[model samples]
Target: MDQLTQIIAVLGVFLYWLILGAVATRIVIKRRSIGVSFSWLLIIYFLPFVGVFAYMLFGELHLGKARSSRSKAMYEPYGKWFSTLYSHNSHQPDKQSDYAASISKLCDSQLNIPSLTSNELELQHTPEQILHAIINDINHAKTTINMEFYIWHPGGLADEVAKALISAANRGVKVNLLLDAAGSRQFFKSEWPKAMKKSDINVVQALIVSPIRMFFRRMDLRLHRKIVVIDNHIGYTGSMNLVDPKYFKQGDGVGEWIDMMVRITGPVVPVINTVSAWDWEVETNERLLPAFPDKAQCTDTSSLVQAIPSGPGMPEEVIHQVLLQSLYQAQKKIVITTPYFVPSEQLLDALVTASLRGVEVNIIIPRRNDSTMVKWASSSFFSELLAANVNIYQFNDGLLHTKSVLIDDEHCLIGTVNMDMRSLWLNFELTLAVDDIKFATKLKGLLQTYMDNSDRLSHDEWQKRPMYRRVIEQVFYLFSPLL
Candidate 1:
């Protein structure tokens, strides 16, 4: 070889070992769970060049330094204000049931979110109903309307809602709209955003992800929350996105999507507003005030809500811990409904343990999932769950998009959180820990409807599945940490 070729060969050999050493060190020291680390190491060894870059782009939980400093600075004042407001309106923990009180306490202790008691909550069951209610609220909105959603299509009933938003903006209502860059990518590209901006509405596309941005932060970390607040008095949240099911994901061939949303009017609305402000600040670098002061405090024994926001900023898996605790505390029944069910081993064990303890455990998942990987990964765990006598149902009607967990008939957690590791550990999720028998009863009725359209999995039948199919499921489950 020539002089230059010899030098290049030596440098390449040295750099290869250096890169391998550095990656191995980072992966080991980070201790990002054994499964995640193993997956990365496997890819690194097998893919070599592809794996090093992949790990660098999507490995760590880091979210860049500038965003970190901004989040830190923003949390201090928000924490103080939340403490002061929560002290006055929070429901006494002693009054709630053991599990309900524990979950509420966990939310307050971790995120300083208080359990609000004076709220009027209405559950919107259908997509059209949710859109109509939001549009009606926008028409009546006098001061401000804030909306944050993971998905917002610019067609169908969603477009009618957009018209309402534009009309509200035209009427001098301050409309602040924030949509996720990934989920609402098409919405941002559509003329609807341009029209809204032209109408002087504050429109923000949150977490504008890019391949170049991956070097600084985990590119897959998503702002998966769905929130809406009108005049700081009325708020809406749940699994429902701002898209009409008719116009959303139609090609998936999973039938029409089904979802649930809750409309709130009372003390809890401000808390939802506060989190929305935090998200806006994170994306726009513009500071906004906490939830506006509302005097509509109804200290009643009816509707109680504690908003729990979980994501990368948090030190622990707040929702995951809450789920485990709730599972352990179940006295009579447990119900969970989600479109995706790929979960960590701990969650699987918890469900199995609950069933082994004779707690009536019913898990509802979609039969015809939009993603085949999600379907197989979710199915891989059914053998263990079924063996433990945990009842599993596949909702054949459509994609059951409601993410909710009901414990007995007293506590219910409803929001955009899925049972998968993505929602449990990565995505910015919003879940309402509701402690009301009335709401739980209503949710139970809704869940029964889902079960009515579902087929129960038989343990014997599941064991008789084709060997190749079972192997495919195991293959998908191997990457559960990533999924």
Candidate 2:
């Protein structure tokens, strides 16, 4: 009995040491941020078995070697197409402005999108307005309609848009639809996709996560971009998902969601089309020609718009860079609204630094969040921001789902990216950078409306929170890096 026990003990020690070595090797090999690597290291060291399993599922950003290679491969064709069509632009006089030059140069060098002038943009605030406008645009589609969303629940406006897409497809307009598998998992498994397929509308699921594929591809990396292009003339993007605001989920307490989207027309349309094409090619391996190769000249507007697409496939974080630069450029004021605010250390520091430099920085978030963990993690930053003289507002009207940034009265960014780690590092996101006084003024007005309905959170109020809640929030904050 003693001999057998000794042999089992030896085997157990060897296995434990092997697991430690394996976990350490994986964390080091991934080349993650030091803070993130250290966090995972600590987890693996303390909770050996559970950490090993969690690391296998979510620790490493292994989005599949084959998929990563294919994403890179598809970019070449996207580059060629963008270069060819964008080179012939005759109405790019606004690109020479200093305000446009700084941001344009940054994005051009990093994201391959030039600062484009001659674009008309309209901001839609309510879900009803946004959905109606989208369906109308779909009904007016002449040649093609391309749509992509993170969450595409079928009902209400989604059903209306579905019927419109079906009608457009029957009329010989090539309709293409793409939705993230994890975001729209139930929809992907429903009969809606099959019905759309039968109607000749090409549909593709982005970054599918399945039991079999989970062992190969990273299931955590999702496609969170929201894009829509109609006949290469009209495009829409923002935080608005395809589901109704009233019935987004089974939740009962939270009221209607307040979301926003931007409708664009001009040279920027083709640029947005290129983003959709790149995603389509990456998932379906089918190159999509521009619905309208030749863009219409629009000298009626002075807005210089650029569509910046950022994701794991890219060599750099394009939107994150823009956000940081915009914060530094803020001289008068900065107003931001997002559903999630679990920002990276760099982003949080930028906001604090900007406020310290005498810029008025206001951050608006929902009063009640969809994720309790995210809400607590977000609240932990309030004390630091309040000390920096940054105004923090929690929306009381409803769930403020708009992801937007307005810097001063001339620079603005509206899109699907939230102020969170997952948006900045893990998921694919898109943003529209607009440099126009008129548009920025309107955006500022809209933000003012939100402020009028929000309750400003004071540092004093934050300190009065119960001890247990504070402890829970701080604990969640420690895991913000992973969040």
Candidate 3:
């Protein structure tokens, strides 16, 4: 062969071996599922040079030290607080003793989280209500305020919230704000309010991305948490980002953004505040402790709540395991509402098994997804679920961003966890696991609202799509393991 042809052959051979080595390394190091491993192998084999680069850049899984430090810092305070609360609360016998013990077992087994007493959880629906609650809480803050969100824009309601934060800071409340670099790129590009700095408010960006750093980090792994902790006593978290009506406003006659938020007080607020502090410490080299006076005296009479935080840095997929276990334990019903519905194989099996065992399994997903590929991949799962007797509903009114799970009308999970591989393994996510019948009932009511507006997909309806669309879904499904 001529020199050029020999050179080309040698380069191709080198690329092939490199990819093989990378795949083998990932399997050994990450210990990912067979599907994920095989999917990586296929990507490298079929896509050649581009695939190799993508794998090198985005495929190498590393549970880095930063995540570990953040998790440790976040959980240490909770551990201390929980140890004290459990000793005090577990000794006294009450009506919620069994529920508290169950919560303790769940924390120890599933999330390794410590259970605390003296926390109140109030479920709030609608953006307007949540916003009003947040503003009211901030206005009453005496010591400090911490706000962290994936998105922060200066317009409409967001602008008003920003003004509220500034006002709180000006009123001697120490305000610390953190926004995800990837999600709030616009806020960073344009100078944020200079008055924030003037008012002694600290603002930091989480996971800043640069052109050079993009080669190593997948920008998709976002800090997709929305938390606002005030006075280390009151907290808020859910699907709502700190944006305005423009985001939800139906341009071209679409629909409004429907979401949910939970206002939490008592012991869980400190946990949420600790997580915010951990995130702030990771971004800026400053450690923050609770600034407010101790006011975590048990206020509510019923229900138990545990705050669970999971991310790539964690040893296990705690949130995913929790969901799977809940599904297995679900006897009557499993109701889930998420904007995205691309679940992993294990999760799919759990849902399918539950459905086959006569559990009323229902999932509500958005009819119009922001991500096209994810929508296709999600749609592909309908056939299998339909076959297994699982009910599926598409929210046709607007985009559904609520992430919640109601299991058997006895337990509920609410927070940032979405039923997707990204949420399960990559993102730093938080969810409040509640063992309250009332909370579960409230969650069921919220799910029912979506179900009322949504259109149920029958097997016939799903199978009636065009052949090309089916092919597209199948193609997307083939890569679902990767997604």
What's each prediction's TM-score? 0.96, 0.95, 0.91
Which candidate number maximizes lDDT?
Answer: 1
lDDT per residue, candidate 1, 314-379, as tens digits? Answer: 646898988888888898899999999987778888899888888999999988999888888898
Candidate 3 lDDT tens digits, 1-483: 699999999998987787678665765577787777777777777886777777776675443456546656656664564455444442232544454456557667655556655656677777778887888888888988889988786666676677788888888998988989888876666545566787888888887777766665665677888999888778999888887646544463546677888887666677778777767766675778554325345544545677788765554678887787778878889999998888988999999999999999999998887778889999889999999989999999778889998888878888998898888888878888777777777878878989999999998887788999989998888777767
Winner by TM-score: 1
lDDT of 3: 0.77
Error of 1 at 94 (Å): 3.4
TM-score preference between candidates 2 and 3, better one: 2
* 50-80 per-residue lDDT for model 2 (tens digits): 8887888887667787777878787776666
Which 10-residue window of candidate 2 scores lowest in summed lDDT? 291-300
lDDT of each: 0.86, 0.84, 0.77
Clashing pairs in 2: none
